[model samples]
Target: MIEEARIKKNLKQFTFPRLSGTDYEIKAYKKLTKEVENLNLKYKVQFFTFSSFYSRIYPKIGFSSVSIILFLFYLNIHMSISIILILILFTILIISIILTRKPEKIQFITKMDSQNVLVKIKSLSKEKKNYDRIALFISHLDSKGQRFTIKIRIRIFKLWITSSISLTATIISKNSILRGFELIFYIIGLFPLIFNLLSTIMMLLNTTDNSSDGAVDNASGIACNLELLNHYSIPENRLIIIYGFFLLELKNAEQWVLDIFIII
Candidate 1:
């Protein structure tokens, strides 16, 4: 049977601060390690770092730039090509500055009280014999700021719609003059894509919440894994559960894991 008390204990331990690279997250990891030890399960803490670019400011700037470009394109003004080149260059420079600016690091941060935190969990059954591994459980315990306004969202949607239409025109048009217009539309379409890319980047650097309160985002999953651990008692098979709290955006890693799962 699943140990409800143990699960609750894990949940309680996770309730504290869990910001990545912070004392809280480190504390949580230590607590997790303790729990694994109490259960006689082998465990390890894996430390990894990723560039904190996306979760900061790229999305807002990219979205704003795309919106402006789309607006200008819609107006049908025949500006000199030189002006367009200058504007694009200026926009790139602005985005580069916004994205590369680093936040001030906290120097006097308190160290996590590692005595109560759990760092890893492993199954005792696997230590004695070889077994086939099934499903991996994963979760992230981080929150981020989403300051995008409704107006910006609407603008992005419209830019996407317009870009799609422009792409279609570029693909189907054959006449030289129409082809030129299609090229212009195709170029406009790029703005939204670029904006989306930058928005994705912005999400990576903005970790603003406890990595452990990730209960809804992950504690539930941990509960499920614990249940799995209890029910699947086959000594010849194994399962690996990972409670991951990251400081960066998770889309790429999540997708890669999903793809691997599908293949396996």
Candidate 2:
């Protein structure tokens, strides 16, 4: 059974910013390992390196691509130029998607080391070796602080995208009524550019800090995982349960790579 008291205790202990690739995060990992050991639960620690380049470059790419696309529209440039820009944008998007799927392919610049803690439990069935299924309980242990909260950032980005799309639609529409208001649409389109430019600048100036404790995002998750580990550690449990404490979900100083655990 999951105990609220135990969850609260764990949450209290872990309620602080533990940014990835930093000493605090390492310390938190150590403490978590200690807790698992105290529970007499076997666990594995996975250490791996990752680059923050993907995370940092995304905003810049969005800003630049949008800027160029709008500029081409504003100038009513040659179709050849517009096509080339579109092709370039498509290529970049494809490459970025590929890179996101395969972090190992990323170059070593801004590389940082982080770890995950995993606890795997096997079924106690007579045919233990042939356990039917595996279960996973995952949580992230790190937190990040930024100039703007996620909500604010999301809203700003959405506004920018919506304005850009509206402008593009209005400018390119065949309807005579829409075409007559091209200048007004263009002016409205500029609002998103201002937002995009400011966002890009903010991203560039962003620095890692320990302001957010991340209780909800998520010490609560860790606490729940811990309780699950405690409950499933018994030999009588019928299913295989793997509890994983990952480095993080948010990008702090560097990215935290997952799926790199070594069973002990």
Candidate 3:
């Protein structure tokens, strides 16, 4: 039976932010593990430690740097060779940043350990071959915070999108006059760049100051994953079901889920 009341009760146990690689994150992981045990299921906790830079810090630095680069690109149309050299460096910096942002890429200097709880359900049929296929379900347990309110976030996204277009226009535009005109979008983008600066600062802040309890951000997702598992049973010799609760979903630092899938 999938008891909504029980799920709600469990969620209440951890109402604070679960920052990636933080103590609170481990507590939540333990709590969830306890629940899995209560259900009389077999599970394993894969403890793996990985160290990386504060995820938000570098990305924010990257964003602010790119924003400056865009502004510089617009302003340096007729600048000297020295200015051009600086622009080249900034461009290379941006490229390097983009490479490091993905989940699979490990470019940070600091490493931290994260846990993934794996629950496996096997088919009960006499023949193991009867259940040939495997189904996997995943959910992340962590939350994040940002500087701008929801309202401002929309405007920020719009600004970012417009900035991309503006940058593209300037890059491809052959005429100086037209390129100058396209620079307006980039100018408008400056407003969000200011917001980006605020975001960068917020990113560097600890989860206590910058992260939220994240009820809607990801609590609901975890709850749903729990509920779905509770509501169903694995058939014997017909299916194998695996449930993985991955830690550290904040700031794009988690790729442990992918690694888990490969292991499965």
Winning model by lDDT: 2
Error of 1 at 192 (Å): 15
- Candidate 1 per-residue lDDT over residues 204-233, each given as its tens digit: 333344433566555554455444444443
TM-score winner between candidates 1 and 2: 2
Please give the lDDT score at residue 227 for candidate 2. 79
Question: lDDT by residue for model 3 over 136-221, one digit each (tens)?
Answer: 67777766666556676566556555655655465445235455465565565456445544544443442233367878767776
| Candidate 3 stretches greater than 4 Å from native | 50-54, 77-110, 126-130, 167-210, 231-238, 249-264
Q: Which residue pairs overlap in candidate 2's backbone?
A: none
lDDT (CA) for every model shown?
0.46, 0.70, 0.61
Model 3 / residue 155 / CA error / Å = 1.6
lDDT of 2 by residue, 21-85 (tens): 78888878887998899888788777777676665665567666765676566556788988898
- Candidate 1 deviant stretches above 4 angstroms: 74-78, 81-133, 145-212, 226-264
Q: What residue runs in model 2 are displaced by over 4 Å at the alpha carbon?
A: 77-94, 127-130, 174-208, 248-264
Question: Each candidate: how many clashes?
Answer: 24, 0, 14
